[model samples]
Target: MDSHPLKTLLHHHLASDASAVQHVPYTLASLTPAALLPSPHSSKWSARITSLLHAKTSDARWAGLCLAQKSALLSQPVMIESAQSWIAVALPLLAVRSLFLPRLNLMYLRTKRKESPPVLRAAIRLLRVIFTTATEMPEFQRQVATPNVAKFTVALISLVETCLDEELKILLLSTLTRIIPIYPTLHRPHQPALTALCFVYLNGNACKPPNAKLTTAASQLYAVLHLTGGKVGAANLWRKAVDDALDFGWTALSSIRTTFLADGRLPQVQSASEPITSVPLNLDRLRCCIVILGDLFSAPVHRLVQVPLGALVKFALALLTCSKEEKVETHLDPTTRMMESLATPRIWALSCDLITALANRQVFLGEAGPVHLTTLQSFGSHLTPSAPRIATCIAFQLEQELTPSERLPFLDALEALFSRCYTTHATLVVNRLAKTVLPCASSVLSQQEETPVVELESNGRSKKGKRVRDFEGDEVFKIRQVVCPTTVDGQIVLRAFAVLQLLLRNGGLSPALQSIVCRVCLSALLALAQMTPASLSPDVRLHALLSATIQKTCVEFASASVDGLSKSLGLIVSTCLAAGTLQHEIEYLLHPRLPPLLRTMPGIEALSLFRTEESEEESHLIKSFGLASVAPSAPPVVRAGSEPVTLLPKRQPTAPAAQPLAPAVEPPAALIFRPTPPAPKPPLKAPSPALKVGPAPAEAPTLPVPMDVEGDETNEDMPSIDLDSDSDSE
Candidate 1:
């Protein structure tokens, strides 16, 4: 040029009067640093000028002004000192990546060698603001502002991507991530710069971009999917990325997978439509995606966006069928192929999680609803042997999310599937059956008595806690206990014992004539709390059920003869009594109805007999059957006129008396049973004449008048008949 424009501008500005500089505003038009390759003529003068610019200044304004003075101000300490002013002027102009800016950045990098990466990272961050504004500029303003800033950003990102230093690349990509949205146009454009950037970003070699960046990139790809008529521009991106990752040619896929699983927000990318990089939809990617989505759904309803649920399900479905080759065929071998055909842990976990999330919202469909039924029915038709288990696991998860009212229905649907899986199949281990139904029992129990308590605040106001006593939410003051039967191979196992004891002792189950249930219950109780753990997890519901189950079992068959009901009951009673938790249930069994049930139980009753010594017999029977007794020391037989005992009492044998008494046999068989009320005719005749005395008019005590058993000694020997049972129905 006539003279380098920056040099000419600087000379003109400097030659002007210092005071006049205040009013005269000068713009640097086409100002740029002189070439590092110097001309022979002005070399010494240029060197002097550079030295002066580098000199220290006492005045800040002077340094600021000098920074604004010319673009030739590189290499000056003043330029570094006047960062704020330099940024103001240079940011707009230097937004573009070119020879000049690269050299300037190199100089800045060299000068700030001692700064930490973070600090240097901060310095480059200013470029984001500049580029952001540059993209928004009007066409004419962009010309005046900065040229090719968008392309420059792409180039800058490319340079970072090519770098070997991982940390630097991460920093650079992070910056690019923020700046890229400045040109939303490139997000879909297949122009050279746009295409190059897509490859560089997708290649992800520089540093594993953060989850946020990957999310953004994913969103952009989705945008492209929507905007570009399903452009094949990105067709190659997904294949290349996934294939390269498989070969370890690129590690970004692994990093992205980690982020996809860990980040609950990735499902938000659903709005990003028509994603080109189906890398995220590949089997491994989908596995992580499902987990993350599930986690989000598992969170409180407020934490999840409602629409994402359907979209995610759709996305997962697409991925499952998208490949040209069957997914099973991709595995290394037959076994691997079989496992793939079945759900992997990650896949199973994903399915469970997704189903759980869907169920959490009462939005059961797909694997959580009717489709799940088909999945169950078809059990391994097209799937591997393990598929049945996977289906069960998924159903179990969905079942777990149903409200108490919904659980039975959910289970019913699942049970059909379970039945189809095989004659014997369970998502839960046998021991873990408690986990399944206890929650249902707990839900019922919670509803039975949710007495609200007021919680006072500092302001003297109060609030009621959630009605359900979920430990995850709030502490519950009361816990209701219930018992359920455990089944094994169509037979009641240890759980049946608990159930029988509960029915007999608590009177809780319906279908009152369930005689088979009783046998089932007794058999399980016979397991004697063996399968019951010594300690239980704090799954409040499960623990309560187990505790109640154990308590019922103990009280029911404690007197088993094999263990001898007394020994068994004693072990249970002592265990419970010593523990102090079973005292209440023990008291409940003392209800009038309980003892006979215990005494009549053949196995249980015989065991009670074993606990008693002849000397201790009557009292021992009273204690074991919990029968009320006249006295602790009362003999089993009462003496009246004292006849030696003919046989044991109908209930249980009693203790013998110390003395033998003479046989007081009735005078005659007829006399032994008194039936003679002379004749009712005497009552009328007596009332007519002799019976005019006092209450004699009561008519000879009324024929068929119930024998005054309380007053009659002979009647005393008669067992107390249950009068209520004798009452004829009207």
Candidate 2:
């Protein structure tokens, strides 16, 4: 007795009097499967939708297509029940009538006139929904989709061939790609047609001008066809595509080379015998070929095949080498000259893309051994001349706000370039490495101190029987910061540091250049150590690494130039002392490496004194003095022989020539300081009772044992005093 809800909503929304259909989608979306197809009215709902789809008017068909798509999305059961009727009517809407007049030899195909855009778009969406819904349920696919695969394939291909609208064609291609994977064999019969259609747009020889969006979609479809079409001949298919593209690209490149030289000058002598049917240089065609190569290389299947790295590298090099010498003249043909002017840069960009694809693939496969080394060698050879230009580009990109995905690859590329080429181009590479590393490291160090404020509610009552106050607090209420460099900032900083270390170890810069580099490295590392979070677990390890690097740098510089080493050591000690951080780091550096150097060098004694004093202070603080307290001892000063010299407590003037004096007690071994081993002192004879009633020879004033100005290792094995002890005994 009641009109169907589907019909009622459709009539209300699609009425001829309705001025705007803007609200129709939302109004229709509100209808649920239960409301449209109640148990009692399910059959009637299907009947109503079928009748509407078969209606003559465009509005009726649009409403029906919209309902079909929504229904397919809402309830898979409803789709299964009425899919036949939906497909039956939707396929007819794509057909265009062609009228032929034999006498005049004219044919008229009315695509737009027959099917309006609204109806066509809706039909495509509805079909996509149907295929997608079928894919989710195996039962539905087996019973409903498997039987109709051929029919659907034929209809979609027919529309693709005759469709005049670009948007519609793209939609058709996308849908075909989606459905092909559902039942790859079902679409096998029509694979050739689909492949050809995709290539039409891919090759940029379509009936209309090339559309980037369309070409991208076509490339995606092409890859899917080969990837999922069948695995039997997939590799061969990829190989053939790559080979054909390379052949065509090389031909086009040769033609361009003949026209323009590397420096943009015309060649003095041209080849006498030109190839028959020389392909003219088409920039679009060239770009398409490069894009294809990029896509093929980027695919996961690339790992299974042997990529032509040599050919790819050579091609990229040739493209990068070809540069325009001067601007185009006004008298030349506008199209030809514009292509020539724009061609080089665009080709260069595409070539770079190809190179990136290869690099990323190599990295992804984890082939970083001999194979990767060979690849890097190839890139380095080609990239040596353009190192500055490439470095500039890399630096400029790094300065931008890039996501981790983008930043990481550029970093990897930069590292690869520097590692292979720094031997010959140390200055250029080292300078760029510094420029890239310092800023990123500084940024990470800055973030370590940023403790954001957080607020918390207290559960316990105050002592006054009032609710605890609410306030913002720093660090106490904030979550504990991560210890490792897990964040993006930390990752960038870590990567930059790695690159810096790599260059420092292998770059082999001259003394002057190395000093500059060592200075930069020390500054960055000190900042990292000083600002490193207290709670971070890597603190000890980071400090150790920093010390090791500094030690190695110092040793290297000392071997080459002592003055530079002194300056670097001075900078390091001064920075550590000033910041009051990296105390352990400085100790590690100074303990073994510092004593071997000349102590007369400025700041060397001060550094030694500072270390000794700090150690004494720490010992005093840690060691407890019992009730029988003792005076704090002075720090033992480090002398030239890498051993500390301490002055023993002066004894009271004994018994002024008194009659009997107790036997003199010898000083403890640790308290004794022997300069030059005391020349194997003669064994002393026992003193006779008659010996010495007069005053004992006044003990020669112990010269403050002359400090070892040149730290010598000969006395390194001598027994040294323990300044940390308070006891006078050994």
TM-score versus the correct structure, for each prediction: 0.28, 0.48
In model 2, which runs have C-alpha deviations exceeding 4 angstroms?
1-23, 28-48, 98-113, 136-139, 205-210, 261-281, 298-303, 326-342, 361-730
Minimal lDDT window, size 10, model 2: 622-631
Q: Against the correct fold, how does model 2 do in TM-score?
A: 0.48
Model 1 alpha-carbon miss at residue 279, Å: 15
Which ranges of candidate 1 are over 4 A from the true structure? 1-120, 133-148, 164-182, 186-283, 287-343, 351-393, 397-730
Q: For candidate 1, lDDT tens digit of each residue in 20-129?
A: 23323443333334532244424433433334333343122232233234422432322333333334433332233344446334323123113233333433453444
Model 2 lDDT per residue over 1-730, tens place: 9866656655565443231134457656677866655566567556656766877677877877887787788877788888877876776676555432232121221233578878988987887777777577788788767876666666666667677888988888888777776667777777787778877776644234557877777776676565544666666666676687788677656654444544555434343432222222255667677777766654434234445556666676666555544453324334443455555555555655655555444312235422221122233443455545555566655555656544665565566655544344546655555555555443433334342222212222333555433366743876655444444444555566556555555433333323334444554555555544443334445444543444444334333334444555666566556545557645555554545343212222222112123344333322321201122323233222232333333332221222322233233342222322222344323344322212234542321122222232243334433344779765
Per-candidate Cα lDDT values, in order, are 0.34, 0.53
